[model samples]
Target chain A: MNAEDRADHFIGRLDAAAAAVEQKLDALLAPSTLKGEIERPARLLEAIRYATLGGGKRLRPFLVIESAALFGLSGEGPLRAGCALEMVHCYSLVHDDLPAMDDDDLRRGRPTAHKAFDEATAILAGDALLTYAFDVLADPATHPDAAVRANLVLALARAAGLGGMVGGQALDLAAESAQKPLNQQEILTLQAMKTGALLRFAVDAGAILGAADQRQAATLTRYGAALGAAFQVADDILDAEGDAAALGKRAGKDAERGKATLVGLLGLEAAKARRDALVEEAIAALEETGLGDATATLAEAARFVALRNS
Target chain B: MNAEDRADHFIGRLDAAAAAVEQKLDALLAPSTLKGEIERPARLLEAIRYATLGGGKRLRPFLVIESAALFGLSGEGPLRAGCALEMVHCYSLVHDDLPAMDDDDLRRGRPTAHKAFDEATAILAGDALLTYAFDVLADPATHPDAAVRANLVLALARAAGLGGMVGGQALDLAAESAQKPLNQQEILTLQAMKTGALLRFAVDAGAILGAADQRQAATLTRYGAALGAAFQVADDILDAEGDAAALGKRAGKDAERGKATLVGLLGLEAAKARRDALVEEAIAALEETGLGDATATLAEAARFVALRNS
Candidate 1:
C-alpha cells in the first residue's frame, strides 16, 4: 500500500485499540457502591475519568498492540498491558498540569485535572491512576503466567521511576534555576528520560508479552528508541508551528518557558531532517527484527509520528 | 515473658529492623551519576532521602518482619518487601502534607517534603518513591520466585491505589467541604481505607511471603485489620493529648481542621476503650492462627499500637 494508505490503516487500528483500552479502563474504574455506604465519593473518580478516557492519540497503546501482533500474540494481555501504560501516561499528564508544575489549565481541549477537580483531588487522582496501573499489570487476568506479569511490572517501574520520567522531571525543574542553557546533549538526555522512556517501554512491553528472545527484544527496543526520538522531534516541530486549538494544549509554551528544544537549537529545517532520519532509523530497526511485511503498520506509525501536524 | 517485657522485646526488635531498612533505603536511593552525566541532580534525591531514611516508627516494616518471622522465612524478601511498603507509606505522607492537602509543615520532627523542598520537587519525589516501591517489589532480588514478586506488587498496588490510600485521601478532602460531619460509620470506613489499608497489607504480605494456607491467611488478615484499627484509634488519642514536641507533628489539628476522627465521634475515654478492645481482638486473632509462641511479638505489637505515645 502507498504511504498515505498505510498511515490511514494505522490510524484506523489506533482508533480501534484506543476504544478497546477505554472500555477496559471504564470497567476497571467504574463507580462503585460498596456495602454500607450512604454515598461513595465521586470527585476523585471523576478527575481520573476526566484525565483519562476519550482523548489523546493512544499512540503508546498502538505501539504495544502492533508490536505484540508482530509475534502473532494479540489478546487481553497486550490490550490490558497497553491500558496500563496509558494509565501511567494519563497520570503523568495530570500531575504535570498541577499548579506547581506546568500550571496548565487546558489538556485535550478540556480543563485539566486540577482545573476540573481541585488540586488535592487532582493529586490523588494522579496517585490513584499510577497505583492502579501496577495493580492492573500484576493481576492474574492480565497474564496467567506470574513471571510475565512480574516482568511487566519491573519494566514499567524502571521506565516510570527515579532514573526515568520522575528524574527527568526533576531535571526539568532544575533547569528553571539553571545558570546556563542546557547544551544539545543535555537536552537530548532530558527529553529521552522525560518522554522517550515511556514510548520505548510501549514497544518493549510487547516483546515481553510475546516472550521474545533477548535479541528480538533488543531489535524492537532500538526501533522504539528511534520512534520515540522521532516523535519528540515532531512534537518540538509542532510546538513551534502548530496552533493551540488544534494541539489541545498551549503551543510555543516550551520556548516561552525557556525550555530547551532541538528545534530551537538546530532550526526548523534541521529539526525536520532529524525527525525524518530517526523515522528511517526506526523502520530499519523494525526490518532487523525479521517480522518483514507484518511491520507495515508499525513502519507507517513511525512515519506518521514524524509527519503528523498535530 | 510478662506483657511489658514482651512489648519491650518487640520494641527492641523494631529498632533493629528499622536500622536494617535504613541501610537498604540508603543504598537503593543514593545519588548516582547515570550514563553521560557530570553530576546527578541532588534536590529530588535529597527530598526523597529526607522524606524517608531517618524518621517515623517504621511500624509497617516492623509488622512485615515480625509477621514473616512466624514462618521462619526471614530473608531479603521480607526486608525488601517491608521497605517497599515503607516507601509507599512515606510517599503518602509527602503528598498528604502538600499545601493543597493537609498543609502540615512538620512531619517526624522535621520540615515536611514540600516545606523542605519546593512543591514540584516534593510531588516528583513522592512520585519517584511510589514508583520505586513497585520496582523494589518486582525485582528478582526481592524474591527468587517471580510469582511471589508479582503477588507483592499486586497487593501493594491494591493497598496504596485508588480504592485504598489515594481514594481515602479524596474522601477526606471532600469531608472538608462536606455539609455534615461524617457519622461514626462513615468515619470508620474512611479511617479503615486511609490508614488501615496499608497496615492490613503489611501483615497480609507476611502471610503471602510465608505461603500460608487460606485459613491461616484469613486469621492473619483479621489480626491485621484489628491492629490497623487500634493504631488509628490510638493516633486519635495522641492527637488529642500528645504535645507537638512528643508527636513530632501538630496536635489537636484534626479538631481544628474539622476533620473527622474516632476521637471526635466517641469522646477521649471511649476512644481509648475502643483501642484497647481492638488490641485484644488483634491478639485473639493471632491466637486463632495456632502459631503459639511465634505470635508473641505480634501480640505485643498490638498492645504497643494501642498504648504507645508518639
Candidate 2:
C-alpha cells in the first residue's frame, strides 16, 4: 500500500480498536457486579460511566493494542488491559478537571464530570475509576499469568501514583505559584510525569501483556517514550496555534494558566521541530524492534502523533 | 494467662504492631523513590506522610496482623500487606476530609490533610496514597507467589473500589442531600460498603496471604464482617454520645451534618446493644475458625472495637 493508504488503514484499525475498548468499558461499568462486589451504587456508577464513556480518541488503548500486536499478541487480554489503562486515563481527567485542580467545565465538547455531577461526586467517581483500573488489571481475565498481571499493576501504580503522574501534578501546581518560571529541564520532568508516564506505560504494558523479551520490551518502551513525548509537544503546539474548533477542548489555556509547556519554552517553530524529531526517534526505536513491516501501523501512529491537530 | 492478662497482652501486641506499621509507613513515605519512579515531589510527599504518619490506632493493620497470625503467617509479607491496607485507609480519610467532601479541619487532633496542605495537595496526596496501596500489594515483597500477589491486588481493589468503600462514600453523600432519611437496610448497605468493607478486607486479606482453606477463610471473613460492623456501630455510638476529646476530632459532626447513622435511626441505647451483639457474633465466628487460643487476640480485638472510648 502507498503511504496514504497505509495511514488510512491505520486510522481504520485505530477506530475499530477504540470501538472495541468502548464496548469493553461499557460492559465493565455496567451494573452487573464482578466477583466479590456487593453493590454498584447507581449515582456513583453513573458518574463513573459519564467520565469514561464521554468520548476521546481512545489513543492510549490504541497504543496498547498496537504495541501488543508487535509481539504477536491480540484478543481479549490485551483489549481489556488497554481498557484498564484507558480507565486510569479517564479518571485522571475527571480528577484534574475538579474545581480544586484545573477547574475545567468542559472536556471533549461536553460538561466535565464535576461540572455535570458536582464536586463531591466527581471526586468520588475519579477515586472509583482509579480503583477500578487496578480491579480490571488484576482480574485473571486480563492475563492468565499472575506474574504478568502483578507487574502490570505495579507498573501502573508507579506511573499513576506519586513520583509519577500525581507527583507531576503536584509539581505543575507548584509551578503555577513558583517564585520564578520553571526551567526547561523542570518542565520536561513535570511533563514526563504528568502526561508522558502514562503514555509510556500504555506500550510498556502491551509489552508486559505479550510477554516480550527484554530487548523487545526495551525497544517498544523506547518507542513509547518518544511517541509520548512527541504527543505532548504536539499538544502544546495545538494548544498554542491550532483550530479551537477542531480540538474539542479548550485551547490557549496553558498560556492562560501560565502552564509550563514546550511551546512556552521553545518557540512554536522549535517545538514543532522537536516534535518531528521525536517522531523520527520513535520510528527509529520501532525499527530497532526487529518487527519490520509488522511495525508499519505503529510507524503511522508515530507520524499521526506528530501530524494530528487534536 | 487469665482473661484480663490476655486482654492486656493483646493491647501490647496491638501497640507493637502499630509501632511496626508506623515504621513501615515512614519508610514507605520517605524521600526515596521506588523501582519505576522518576521523582517524588516534596509537597506531595509531605502531604502523603502527614496524612499517613499523623497518628491513628492503625486498627485496620492490627486486624490484618492478628488475622494472619491465626494461620501462623508472619514476617515482612504480612507487615507490608498491613501497611498497604493502612495506606488505603489513610487515603480514604484524607479524601473524606476534603472541602468538597466532608470538609473537615481536624483529624486526630491535627489539621486535616487539606487544611495542613492545600485542597489540591490533599487530593493529589490521597490519590497517590491510594495508588501506592496497589503498588505495595503487587510488589514481590508482599508475597512469594505471584498468584498470591495478584489475588491480594484483586481483593484490595474490590474492597476499596466502587462496589465497596468509594461507592459507600457516594451513598453517604447522596444521603446528606437525600429528600428522606435513609432506611435501616439502606444504612446497613451504606455502612457495610463505606466502612465495613475495608475492615472485612483486612481479615480476608490475611486469609489470602496465609493460604487458608475455604472453610477457614469463610470463618475468618464472617468474623471480620461482625467485627467491622461492630466497629462502625461503636463509632456511631461514640459520635452520638461520647468523647470529643478522646476521639481527637469532632464527635457530633454526623448529627451536625444531618448524616444518617444507626444511632440516629435506632437511638444510642439500641445501637449499644447492637454493638454488643456484633461483638458476640464476631467471637462466635472466631470460635468456629478452629484456631482455638490463636483466635483469642482476634476475639479481644472484637471486644476492643465495642469497648474502646475512641
Candidate 3:
C-alpha cells in the first residue's frame, strides 16, 4: 500500500477494533444475571453502558488487539481480553469524572456519567465495571489456560490498583496544593502510575495472551513504556494548547489547577521534542522484536499517539 | 467441653483469625511498591490502612477460615484469601460512607475514611483496596492450583460486582428515592445483592480454596445462603430497633429514607422470626454436609449472626 492507503488501513484497523470492543462491552454490560448472583440493577448498568460503549479513540483496545496479532494469534481470546482492559479504562474515567475526583461535567462530547446519572449510580457503575473486568479475565472464556487468566487478573489489578493508577491520582491530587512544583522524577513516577501503567498494560496484556516468551515480552514492555510516555506527553501538550471544543472536555485546566505536567516543566517545544524521541524509541523497540513487518501497525500507533489532536 | 467453654473457644478462634487478617492487611497496605509499578503514595496508603486495619467483626474472614478448616486445610493460603475477602468488605464500607452514598460521618466509632482523609483520598483508597483484593486473590501464593485461583477471582468478582454487593447498593440507593415501598420479592433481591452476596462469598470462597466436591460444595452453599440471609435480616432488625451508640451508625435511617427492608415489610417480630429460622436452616445444612462436627463453628457462626448486638 502507498503512504495514504497505509494510513487509511491503520485507521480502519483501529476503528474496526474499537467497534468490536464496543460490541463486547455492550454484551458484557447487559442486564442479564450471571451465575452466583441475583439481579443487575438497571440504572447502574445503564450508567456503566453510558460511560463505556461509544466514546474515545478506543486506543487501548486497539493496542491490545494489534499487540496480540504480533504473535500470530488474531482470534477471539485477544478481543475478549482487550475488552476487559477497556472496561478498566472506562471505569477509571467514570470514577475520575465524579464530583469527588476530577469533577468534570463533560467527557467525549457528552455529559459525564455523574451528570447524566446521579453520583451514587456513577460510583456504583464504576465499581461494577472494574469488578466485571476481573470477572471477564478470570472466566474460562477469556482464555482456556487457567494460569494465563490468573496472571492477567494479577497484572491488571496491579496496573489499576495501588502503586499504579490509584496512587498516581492521589499524587496528582496532592500536587495541586503542594508547596513546591513536582520534580521531573516525581512527575514521571506519578504519570507512569496514573496513565502510563494502563497503557503499558494494554500491550503487555497482549503479550500475555499471546503466550510470548520472556524475551519477547520484555521487548514489548520497552515498546509499551516508550509509547505510553509519548502518549501522556502529547496529551499534556493538547491540554496546554488545545481548545475545549476540540478536546471534548475542559482544557487548560492543568495550569489552572496547578497540576504538575511535562508541558509545565519542559516548556511546549522541549515536550514536543521529548514526544518525538519517545516515538522513535517505541518504534526502535518494536523493530528489535524482529517481528519486522508484523510490527508495522504498532510503529504507526507510536506515531499516532504523538500526533492525536484530541 | 462445657457450653461456656465451647463458646469461649469459638470466640478465641474468631479473634485469632481477625488478628491474623489484620496483620496481613497492615503489611499489604504498607507504602511499598510491587514489581511493574511505581511509588505508593503515603496518604492513600494511610487511608487504606485506616479503613481496614482496626474495624468491625472480621466475620467474613472467620467464615473463610472455619469453612476451609472443614477440608482439614488450616494454612496461610486460607488466611490470605480471607484477608482478600476482608479487603472487599472494607472497601464497600469506605465507599458506602461517602457523602454521595450513605453520607455517614463515622465508621467503627471513628471518622469515616472520607471524613478522616478528604473525599478524593477516601474514594481512591476504596478503589485501591478493591483492586488490591483481586490482586491478592490472583497471586500464585493464594493457591497452588491456577484453576482454584481463577475460580476464586471469578466467584469474588460476581459476589462483589453487578449482581452482587455493588448492584445491591445501587438498588438500595434507588429504593430510598423510590416512588413506593418495595414488595417482598423486590426487597429480598435488593438485600441479597447489597449484603448477602459478600457474606455468602466469604464461605463459598472457602469451598473453592478447599477444592470441595460438588455435593460438599452444595451443602456449604446452602449454609452460606442461610447464614448470609440471617445476618442481613439481623442487621435490619438492629437498624430498626438498635441504638445508634450500639450500631456505630445513624439508627433507623433505613426507615427514615423509606428504604425497603424485611423489617419494614414484615414487622420487627416477623423479621426476628425470619432471622431465627435462617439460623436453623443454616445449622441443618451444616448437619447435612456429612462432615459432622467439623461444621460446628459454622453452626455457631449462624447463631452469632442472628444474635449479635452490634
Question: TM-scores across all candidates?
Answer: 0.98, 0.98, 0.97
Encode model 3's per-residue lDDT on A51-159: one tens digit a residue: 9888878899899899999987776788888888888998899889888888999999999999999998988888988999999999998889999999999989988
The whole-model lDDT of each prediction reads: 0.88, 0.90, 0.88
Best by lDDT: 2
Candidate 2: tens digits of C-alpha lDDT, residues B152-239: 9999998998889998999899999989999898898889999999999999989999999999999999998999889999999989
**Docking level of model 3:** medium
What residue pairs are clashing in model 1? none
* Cα lDDT of model 1 by residue, B28-86, tens digit: 77764222233445788888899999887888988998888887789788999999999
lDDT (Cα, 0-100) at B70 in candidate 1: 87
The model with the greater TM-score, 2 or 3, is 2
Tens-digit per-residue lDDT, A1-310, candidate 1:
8766877788898889888888877777777522222344577788888888988888898898898898888989899999999999999999998999989999989999888888998999899889989998999988889999999999999888777888788788888679999888887877788898899999999999989989989999999989988999999999999998889888998899888889989999999999999999999998998878998888988998888878
In model 2, where do residues sit more than 4 Å from their true spots? A34-39, B33-38
Task: Note the residue pairs that clash in candidate 3.
Answer: none
Task: Note the clash tally of each candidate.
Answer: 0, 0, 0
Runs in model 3 deviating more than 4 A are A33-39, B33-37
